[model samples]
Target: MSGPRKGKPVQPGQTVVVIGGGISGLATAALLAAEGHKVTIVEKQDVLGGRAYTFSEDGFRFDAGPSWYLMPEVIDHYFRLLGTSAEEQLDLVKLDPGYRLISEGASEPVDVPAGRQRVVQLFERLEPGAGARLEKYLDSAAETYTMAKRRFLYPTFQSFAPLLTADVLTRLPRLARLLLEPLHSYARRYVKNPSLQQVLEYPAVFLGASPFTAPSMYHLMSHLDLDVGVYYPMGGFARLVEALEKQARDAGGTIRTNVEVLEIETAPVTSRRRPAAVRGVRVRNGGGSVESLPADVVVSAADLHHSETALLPRNLQTYPERYWQRRTAGPSALLLYLGVRGVLPQLEHHTLLFTADWEENFKAIFGKDTFIPSPASMYVCRPSATDPDVAPEGHENVFVLVPIPPDPGLGGSGDERLERAADAVIGQLSEWAGIPDLAERIVVRRLYGPADFERDYHSWKGTSLGPAHTLKQSAFFRAGNVSRKVEGLYYAGASTIPGIGIPMCLISAELVVKRLRGDTSTGPLPVPLRAAGVAEGTVPKGTTA
Candidate 1:
């Protein structure tokens, strides 16, 4: 599986040094390797899948980051590009009624069903004829998503040329309208129930914005939920990482774990054509080995600012420190992975416990910039319920997350504070799910907050998903896949163009490879040129004068 070659091969075996083992880096390596180039992914951690990585404790498995698997088609395409399908590599089952959302107590939980017809029916029951209105709303969402996927998503907007097409220019009005309405206002027009409205707005929170302020375009997520359908990989979300890791290796990409990148060396003068290219990377391992790996192309899937400031030399810095500091970032998550000993029948595959004071909770985090000691809203996922292999029989694997500001400034999430907050959340979960006395039912539990994300992943300011998708920090406004100042340098991750989420990160990888190769043909290229590519200085076999 390879992209069709357009011009002669631009550069051969251009040893691509990808710093980070997250899905972004792995996807980058896969695309580059498929193009007949030698690729190596260096990760600081002992495992692949950065924030999406998994950990096992005593027998219970947990995804350290991103538990939900949205947009199955995007993942399917990744596998297709790697010479297989998601079904062939892994087992995927669709979740019915995607999630359950409740307030303080759930005498009657708001069941958000899966698929368009079912969800519409559920809405109709909640509020008369609301389903038909939702269907109409979703039809519009589908159109927006189609436009977004084709016109905006797949293209590498490293420069404006890709986005300046006549087709896109004509679509500006729709795009502007989509961006104009607030998600809360937009949803309220269709659905009357406050609880259903909260359900529709959950994905915006994932973008690290409040529904009242988050763009109306976010309603596309609800459309994605009902249209695309919520799905679970057989062994849980971690299986995605494993599958991706295999693809990279299969494409002849090398992955080195426990190797932390310390510095990036780049050329000095920026040429208008090629600009400055990355020379190599210096790394340190736990065993105390410090060494530099040579490369012609370097793509960092790590935190954008960290790679620019800490890993690259001062003279090679692209953007100033003040730039990143001023940007709003997605909420840093407070995560809990719990292994329950007994049954909790009331809960579904996904659950959102809404806070009574939603606006106040948001203001506390985004506006006031403080951790909500008692966050009104939380997301809970029961992967084991859908995928039995994730845990032992009769036992359950649960992942709960609450969004908070990046700052833990004065005292951090102290022991007493985190415990108290977690307890309060569990209490809400219990009441919502109709599970009695959940506090005593836990056999195993693990808690992670801003401190853990910062320590484990080196996430900038302990942010969970990367920079917030604000107007100024989105699309062309965000970092380019190719370096603006440094040549042979690139970025592929949630922080870069196309924004956050697993699918976007995967595409970010593709964008980096596209920049290096400069073509978008489907399938593999000529064999001889593919076989003779060089790692650094030499021009690739297919290049022309």
Candidate 2:
């Protein structure tokens, strides 16, 4: 479906300073550079990819974040708009058992195979009529996913026009229920079996939400992993970040590392004007020199809480400290990076271990009186099962994540409590998942907790995935892409419009472009600019881009 255009089109050579070197920052730089913007990305860290940063220790290379490659179409489309393709950039591999699921004291683990029919058969075996239930559930999910992509996800909801679209108007009743009901309740309406039901529940955890609280609109999440298929970029997800970095540079954008943005500088548009216009960023370089990086536009791809509260003044802030008082932050994690001595046959490339009491575990993470869950459910990724480059020869690369309350009070990396939590997780996996020698086999280990996230990413409440995808924080309510209190200030990434995950970050970058281009099309713009007024300079004339 086509959308109407409004707002002013971008001029030829406006200067843009993109704050952060994360995926969204790199992507936005690449896009605006193609439009002839004098684009520069300033990263506080010495390396790029923000959370997706990679490190090599003891010959075991680790992708510090984003292990799953769930949405290939979003990735492919994003690269396509940049005049490249994911297939052209990265070597992708599809896994047969998309992921493995294990439960405490279960006789056998469940393998969610790649084929749809096979998954349905497994569902039926687990619960009578569940295969048909899964089909019905996914059918609804697929429709919702498609509608969201076409209408809700793509458009920069700077205006209310997107809300009145035919697709949305027709489904107002269905969407209202989705907004009101929680995911766990929605899933139970279809299947009663605990094992089969868990298939839906686990995604909510990774999404930084509790199944009992997160909106049912998120039920579409299962359709992505269970039905759409899971993939990996043969080396690691960091390789994808490297590809984006190269693409940004190739598009004539400059990336400056080891530079911290001290403030988002602003000035009044006129002496009488109410909202200030973004002038540039105040920065402190690695050499300890402070200077102003002047720009006509500034896009903060950093954490929204950090950008609004720390960078901008309180008067110019869109979301003040008082605002977040009512908002719910997503879960923070206790991250364990382990390099084991030998391969572990019990785990898959992607595996999920659920405690017998996952609901209680979620309460520990998201409830008002938050605490760490013991005998906790966790996610383990043994990428060495497929990607050999991540680990050393005769060794396995293990990454364990246990979701915890997003409280910075829990402390930083190497903190005693955090380490004890990691230790408990290791022991639980050894007993529950049948990896008896898990602890002793460890040759390398590192623990990262909430405080580490706060120190490195300036995350609000040290949350790893940004704000929770609750009803109050979804769609237009998530935080607008463009600022209302400041002119020429825009936001992208997991913090703003369209919400979380790698694919959403990609869309967020595109939404920033849409806002700038005044191209308010809800559907994704076609590549090569077939129309007279398409994206500038990214694609060449003719020859089927």
Model 1 stretches with alpha carbons more than 4 Å out:
1-10, 105-107, 269-275, 373-375, 408-414, 519-545
Q: What digit string (tens of lDDT, one per residue) describes model 2 on residues 298-410?
A: 99999999999999999998889998888899999999999999879899999988877868888889877999899888899999999888998999999998889999999
Candidate that scores best on lDDT = 2
How much is 447 displaced in model 1, in angstroms?
Answer: 0.9
How far does residue 54 in candidate 1 sit from its true spot (Å)? 1.5
| lDDT: worst 10-residue window of model 1 | 521-530
Per-residue lDDT of 1-545 in model 1, one digit per residue for the tens? Answer: 11122323346657889999999998888777877778999999998899888888867888877877888877777666555677877788878877787775435888777778888888888888888998898898888777677766766653455566677789888778768778878888888777777767778876767777777877778767878888888887688888888878877889999999888876666444444667899889879899989997788999887887787665556655777778887887777889998767778888878876777777776885576647467888888777777677788888998887775441134556666777888887776677877878888877777776677777778877788866666656677665555767778898877779998888787666556666442222222123233443332222211
- lDDT, candidates in the order shown: 0.75, 0.86
User: TM-scores, in order shown?
Assistant: 0.90, 0.96
lDDT of 2 at 71: 78
Query: Looking at candidate 2, what is the lDDT of residue 495?
Result: 83
Error of 2 at 230 (Å): 0.5
